[model samples]
Target chain A: MNKVLITGSEAAALGAKLAKIEVLGYYPITPAFPAMERLSKYIEDGELNCKFIRVESDHSALASVLGGSLAGARSYTVTNSQGLLLMTEVVYHAAGLRQPIVMGVANRALSAPHSRFPEHGDAVSQGATGWIQLFSENNQDVLDNTIQAFRVAEELRTPVMVNYEGYLQSHTLEEVFVPDQGKVDAFLPLKRMPALDVTNPRGVNTVAGPDVYTDYKYIQNAAMEQALELIPKVAADYNREFGANSCGLIEGYMMDDAEHAIVAMGSIVGTARLLVDELRKQGKKIGLVKVKTWRPFPAQAVNQILKNVKYVTVLDKNIVFGVGGALATDIKANLYGQGSMVINGAILGLGGGKCGVKEIKEAVDHTESSENKNRSEWIGL
Target chain B: MAVKNLPIVPSGDPGALVEAANYATWRIFRPVITESAKVNPIVTLYCPDGAITVDESGAEVNYKLCKGCGICAKESEGIQMVPEYTGPKGVF
Candidate 1:
């Protein structure tokens, strides 16, 4: 393994480089700009032989990568908050076309009161676009999951979104062991182009009439469902090669016999884990559940994991405004009528404001004491 | 490219996540806009504190009226609004 002191953005760039990406199509956005900038410098210095396309907008950036993938090139890009939203249209198209493109999303809040801090709103917004969504809880997971995402995407012929908190992971530098190039090359072969034969002129991005539209949509949904099934196998294969396995919808820490659990995603789970350890020493039976994959819902896995718990608190960085926390709603949707008191705490941290270990501990403690059910409370507002 | 005022759904809507997710999912099976579709451009305004507001129709009319608040570019969906740094002949 190659050792490098890298930020989350650089790790993603290095991961893609290891995957032997042939095309880098990107537009700069806060918290995600450094990755693309590094790739650009690499290309300029002849360190990597890749075609880097600088687009005018994020939409064009995604569109260009999709086009590049169709031409049998391994393409990658990075985006965040507004940038992710800007590319929303093509994000869906890329997945629907079953193009095995990989993207890194720096999670941040959507605008109105625009902030550049970390939040799940941006990445979670695209959860239903048929793109496989994976949330990284730390800098290391960011690197590993990003590399694995490409293999999973290629296997399923669907796009994958590897999400990390914007400033938290993107800007924070960490020590990471970069994988060996030769080993990576062996593990991740250059993706073969889909059977696009010039001999047969076939139209892509065609307008389907109503008669075939429904069937096509059904096929897309089936493909996504297939991705959910195939991800674990691919992740397992990855583990065999690297001796590190990090799959599954939710990763539980000290939850085997805990009565109370806290469910969260992205880098905040790291903070929660530390808090869990501190609380454990004080004889508190509290555990933490870090959600790695937010899409394909992972409803069954979540339900099964949290089934025995008496009270569960879900901390969501993004608010749905009128209703409740986004993750909380999803959890409730899946665990409806389960007789568990699940409290949804919408916390304004690292987005609207800075959130640290102290605030996270307070939220967990508050939820542990409250007997509220089906109620959503905003924390640190 | 040009700024315009637009009414936006409040940021506090809890359903925005679900709604945005649904819209994105539907886009996978359908196009964002059908043929001959009419779309109104919304200008995003970015404030100093990172607050964003969408102006659909009636914020400011003149290109010269822009104070470079950046709220429009930061808050607007699907595009980044930045000052035109290049000459008209130069490509972005």
Candidate 2:
């Protein structure tokens, strides 16, 4: 129950330990490597009773957890960038199979000219994979989101990816109050895997042809859709117990009556918050809308928040290459024909470059001053 | 399986590129390989105690200075170059 100065990776490790995760299947990748190391140390010290599977690749890391989960074990893993991509196939399958697994993704860029800093491309690429993607902006959220992630995943019978910016939050040390183990224990009881009886012998992950494949896919989509409704309710309950509420799908900071706002996800929200403070001091009616959850898209919530705003700029760390920024496209899809000056996309901080408060402030300033017709501008060079 | 005339980006260190590409490809293909076949080359690359590092930008790696000692590849089975092709020009 003591306060500890730890990085986001350590916070995730501690959260998993507190949740009493039974098995951890993982491969070491940048940013996420620290979490694996911490968990390995915990396993060595016997502080937590868990099976640590040292997999050769991220694909095995996720597959092992999926296998473990099917065997009725509370399982988890950590991955990033190409590692996340390596596990992309199972990532989709894990959710389709309704395995209540949780993973920590240190959001990094995908390949071509791969860079290992931090970006949302890795997690965003898996958007259609049907997992609940939660973006954490700080060390505390990293811990809280991870602990709740398991519970949310179980409730919805799907996997959850707790996405945070690599190096930005993952490696940066911050003071995070370790919640009381007893309190966490009360919220997340020892995860008892659904009773798998030999007498019942229900078939799991069976091969389905055209007839049932579509039906199965619908079921998976329906479960993900259910998460859009369930996440907020679970987050509310978690807040009541933990005294901390992560804005659920999207968090709005000083948005009421604001004229222009910046929309983003992951660690950039922190930088946006600081910029908002500075802009507020100058009496510029600008605010920020940080998407805490991205998979379900939170279309209704995003449109509702940006309904009154005249100009909205979406800052995306990862670009879709041919088509603008990923978040920008998503926002545009949600806000189609709203008559608001919607900027479609902006790409910045590719290959792990830092996006600081100055860059955020500049983006807002340029967007506000520009007279273009719904165009996107990349910030921080 | 031998990749025929794989299009590899010409960067400084081909080994690092191959390693990184192998790691990325492994991640992208992990779920399918692990579930269906355990004998996948990707899985073999990600063997226990293996590691991968991707330098997509080629900003940090100096291929001209590299001696191809294979220290990183040998250290961990998971390590590979970013592009999956070796040498400066990346031929065969």
Error of 2 at A239 (Å): 1.4
Model 1 error, position A217 (Å): 1.8
Give the Å shift of residue A54 in candidate 2.
1.3
Q: Tens digit of lDDT per residue, candidate 1, span A1-381? A: 756788998888877877878888988899899888878877888877889988899999999998888777888999999999989999988877778899998888788676777788888678778898998887778888888888888877778898988878888899887777887778787768643446654446555446556666676677677766777777777777777757656788999988888888888788888888998999988888888888767787888888888778787877776767778888888889876565556464637465567777777767767777667766676
Model 2: how far residue A311 lies from native, Å: 0.6
Find the candidate with the highest lDDT and give its number: 2
- Residue A62 accuracy (lDDT) in model 2: 93
* Fnat per candidate: 0.00, 0.00
Compute DockQ for each candidate against the true complex.
Answer: 0.02, 0.01
When summed lDDT is taken over every stretch of 10 residues in candidate 1 chain B, the lowest stretch is: B27-36
How high is each candidate's TM-score?
0.78, 0.78
lDDT of 2 by residue, A162-274 (tens): 98778888898998878788998898876666524456554455445465566666667777888889888878888888777666888899999888889998888888899
How big is the positional error of residue A6 in model 1, measured in Å on the Cα after superposition?
1.0
